[model samples]
Target chain A: MNFNATLIGQMIAFVVFVWFCMKYVWPPMMKALDERKKTIADGLAAAERGQREHELAEERARESLVEAKQQAQEIISRAEKRAAEIVEEAKADARTEGERMIAAARNELDQELNRVKEELRGQVVSIAVAGAEKVLEREVNEQTHNELLTKLAAQI
Target chain B: MASDTLTSGEYIKHHLTNLTFGQHPDGSWGFAHTGEEAAQMGFWAIHVDSMFWSVLLGFILFYIFRKAAKNAHAGVPGGLQNFCEWIVDFINDTVRGSFSGRNPLIAPLAFTIFGWIFLMNFMDLIAVDLLPWLAQLFGQHVLGVDPHHVYFKVVPTTDPNITFGLALGVFILMLYYSIKMKGVGGFFGELAFQPFPKWMFPINLILEGVALIAKPVSLALRLFGNMYAGETIFILIALMYSAGIVMAGFGGLLQLGWAIFHILIITLQAFIFMTLTVVYLDMAHQEHH
Candidate 1:
């Protein structure tokens, strides 16, 4: 094999060129690719995060709606309870007023009966005095007639 | 009178010469002289033609790639961007797939190697005598250099040294990746213990040794043989025209067909080189043999 200066020079040039290209050119190219991959991955991650957040918000909204519905049901039931209470209070008041009216009527009847009884007594006594005058066909003493009329009135 | 009365062999040999200045006394190899070296003086000159065009083609491709990258799209690509994206994806999927380990440097190195060698191989499609003839005219008439001494060879692929040099670079890279991955001790241990126990170290060492040296040799010879054969055919056909063949039209058509066929050769050679490089690198990264 011939080994000359030119051959040596060619060998050196080849080694140098290959080494330089491998060191400088190849690295940046690979780095650019890695960066591109990272960018794509980041984009996907952001998209996934956004989707998760949206889903969470939707779930929260659904829960709030359910809670609102439950609250509305509770309020309606509370109003119903209030209405029933008002009805019950009205019924109790009506019962109390009826009993008071019945008592007043009873008292009024007793007073009327007493007045009627007193008038009747007065009439019976007059009648009895007239009867005694007739029976004797002549005048009698006042004390005797008065006593008879009182006894007749008591019996009636 | 002698100049005008030159035989066909002398003409062909004259045209076969390179744009070199100095000649070795033995007529095989020498350092290049400034202006008087024989056209085919040294092994290096054998590829001087290819070197010039290959570098030029590489720069042009680099420029194109840079421009595409500068204007790259994050979305739908168009024009050069589309082509570049396809090429990048192809290298990743194909070359990267062939290798065992994911090398960060291998892909781009493969790309440059493929493009450079393929471009050099493409020079084989040019008529074997075209560039030398052109060089002869320029050297004798324009540059005032003797046409005989003006040496240049446009096809670098036909030179074994250039291919071997390139293959050697890949070999060195393979070694580096192996060492880096396995450490020096581990690398040697692999050589001594691969495919058997430590007692069979001699056999393992021999196998590993053969495998290591064969890498560059196979790579160089594969490329050199293909391109040399292709150039030989072109030269023989060229001889037809110079032999006073009256049917130049038929010869021209045949040349065109051969050039078209050579395109496949060029592309295949480039692919093979890149794929092999990736495979070798992949092997280097493996912890086992």
Candidate 2:
């Protein structure tokens, strides 16, 4: 091809385009790309930190749940022990009261039996005195015989 | 295009020429009517089509980039932002890999070179005759200009001037960095005296001088040659359409295959140019050079 003024024109155009690109187009695009890279890196780092925190929170929750269950079991076992102790104490008190009531009933029955005996002796003495009176109407004084019969009843 | 009265040779020639506008032989300033007329205008003539297409493509590049830049954010990127960021990252990584110094301009320069050149070269994949044919039609109907005189080359990189223009800009930057980093004396010394004794300074001068100049020369030529050859092949393939229906279908298949292959070539050339620019600038920045 024949060389001409077009060479100079193309050169000028080349310079202008390169200058324009450097001044306007190149920097902004490069800045955007670099900024996006940094942003992505920061986002990824934040995501990693969040994951770590989530894992730690889960671990703490698990530990808290285990501890709470252990505490509930301990409280339930303590309550059961206390209930058993109360039941044993009540059984012991009921047994002692029942034995004391039986002893009082037996004493009352003995006192009743002694009283009946005394009455029977008195009746028997009266009958014997009557028979003696019939038999010994002619012998012995009446008042002295009655006094002896009373002393015999007291001895019975 | 095959239905035209032009022979295949003229068609190929038609595809290669640029729409030149300059002072004619009669001292009249206007568009060139032929390739010989364009040459007659000499170095003063401007290739209007290459300049027009490149500048338009550059503006388009700016529009998309500016839009993406405006909407770019630190959050998840939208589709356009994603695309823009992908290119930015690639250029950044490339500059980082090749450029050792911390010049803020290097990445953007590399980016511009890659993007601009890629867009320019991408013009090659468009049907070789499509835009030129449309341009010819416009010239004929609207401007009342002759269709034969409406020479337009769409792909700018195919022109040595355009590639050299880009290379010259990078070359200037390299020189600036060289002098800035190593001082003028050290830079000259690196060129005039190296890999030999003080007695061999003359030989060293020639050797080092050639090596130094070859950087930009090779850079410019490599891209120009590749693109020019590719365009020529495309034009040659297009000529097959004039032979017959069978030839036209074969030409279509060939054009498709070549275009698919050119996708790699275009991207590779752009990549190579960008990498070399960074490397050359890095060489400039090196104090031990």
Candidate 3:
């Protein structure tokens, strides 16, 4: 076949165009796609990491809450025990004070009763002596008076 | 115009020709004419019948698939589903056998190309004279373009420009895979060190470069030559009968047999083109020989 220059030029141009497409166009486009794939993967990984951190933080919060709850329970139990002790101490103090006040009142009443008994014994003896003096013009013997005084002391 | 002087066959032959540019006798760029012209666009040429038919068929297939998918069943498929699945499977298998790299794009592209080219090649089964004659009926009796001057070649693959253009597209794709698989430096190094030991780098480089050029040339020529030859034989056989020769009956029989034989040729040529495309892409995807 007789080759024409135009055909040769076209063939050349075709070769050049093929080369250009291979060299310039294809590589970059494929690379861009690969990069896009990698970007998506990385984004997913980052998202996963974020999710994991959030979960971890939540877990820690839950743990802290449990720890705080335990601590709060302990404090409440200790406070209750202390309150019980304070109530017991107050009750004991009130009981002791009441017993002391009753003992003091009994001692005061015993002293007053003793003084009244002595006054009454003295008055009875004086009244007996005045009666004997009016009844008897003459003086009585000491032995008879002693016997009556003893009997009166015994009776009082 | 002088076009009125030519027969239908000769008129058809002329339009089937190429418009050449550059290389004048005076040694400056001048215009000339060759039977091979680029399809009228930057990337597409006018000579390609396969491209046109393929695109049309692709759209048709796309519409059918969309409809089938829309009315799809979770149970056994309907008639359309079976047909669509069969084609999809065929295309997938072709891609699987041909391509090496895991490209989500190449499989569909190959399917589209295969379907389109097959449809275009199927156009050859139509009577060679049927469409052109029909056009003449409309032109001479109706629109009046002069039946004697009405010219059209319905078979696009019969045009060298079209076949060559398709081959060139495959060649471009091959180069793309090569570069993508291997970086620029790696790709150049491959050519520089191919088919020989590193000790023979200089000779290897030259040989490799020639081999690279030969790839597209052979690819284009093989397809163009087959389609062109098939069309020419059919036309010649038709002419023999139309000439009212003694061998007219024999010519008709021979033409019939040839047309039957040509079914294989057209199909084979399309398959070869597609197969080679896949092979080239596979080779490009390879990092080593």
Best by lDDT: 2
Name the weakest run of 10 consecutive residues (lDDT summed) in model 3 chain B: B36-45
Off by over 4 Å in 2: A93-156
| Candidate closest to the true structure, highest DockQ | 2
lDDT of candidate 2 over B1-289, digit per residue (tens): 6437787778888889999999999999999999999999989989999999999999999889989998889998999999999999999999999988899999999999999999999999999989999999999999999898899899999999899999999999989998998899999889777889778889999998889889999999999999999999999898888888999999999999999999999999999999999999998999873
Q: Candidate 2: deviation at residue A144, Å?
A: 9.5
> What is the model-wide C-alpha lDDT for candidate 1?
0.70
Error of 3 at A153 (Å): 99
Candidate 3 is scored at a TM of 0.54
Clashing pairs in 3: B18-B35, B39-B45, B39-B46, B40-B46, B49-B156, B54-B116
Give the DockQ (2 decimals) of all models: 0.06, 0.74, 0.01
Q: Model 1, range A87-151, lDDT digits (tens) per residue? A: 99989888888888888888888888877887888786666666767887766666766676677
Q: Residue B178 of candidate 3: its Cα lDDT?
A: 84
- In candidate 1 the C-alpha lDDT for residue B221 amounts to 86
Top candidate when judged by TM-score against the true structure = 2
What TM-score describes the B chain of model 2? 0.98
**Residue range with the least summed lDDT across 10 consecutive positions in model 1 chain B:** B31-40
Number of clashing residue pairs, candidate 3: 6
C-alpha DockQ for predicted model 2: 0.74
Name the docking class for model 2.
medium
Which segments of candidate 3 are over 4 A away from where they belong?
A1-156, B1-74, B141-143, B245-248
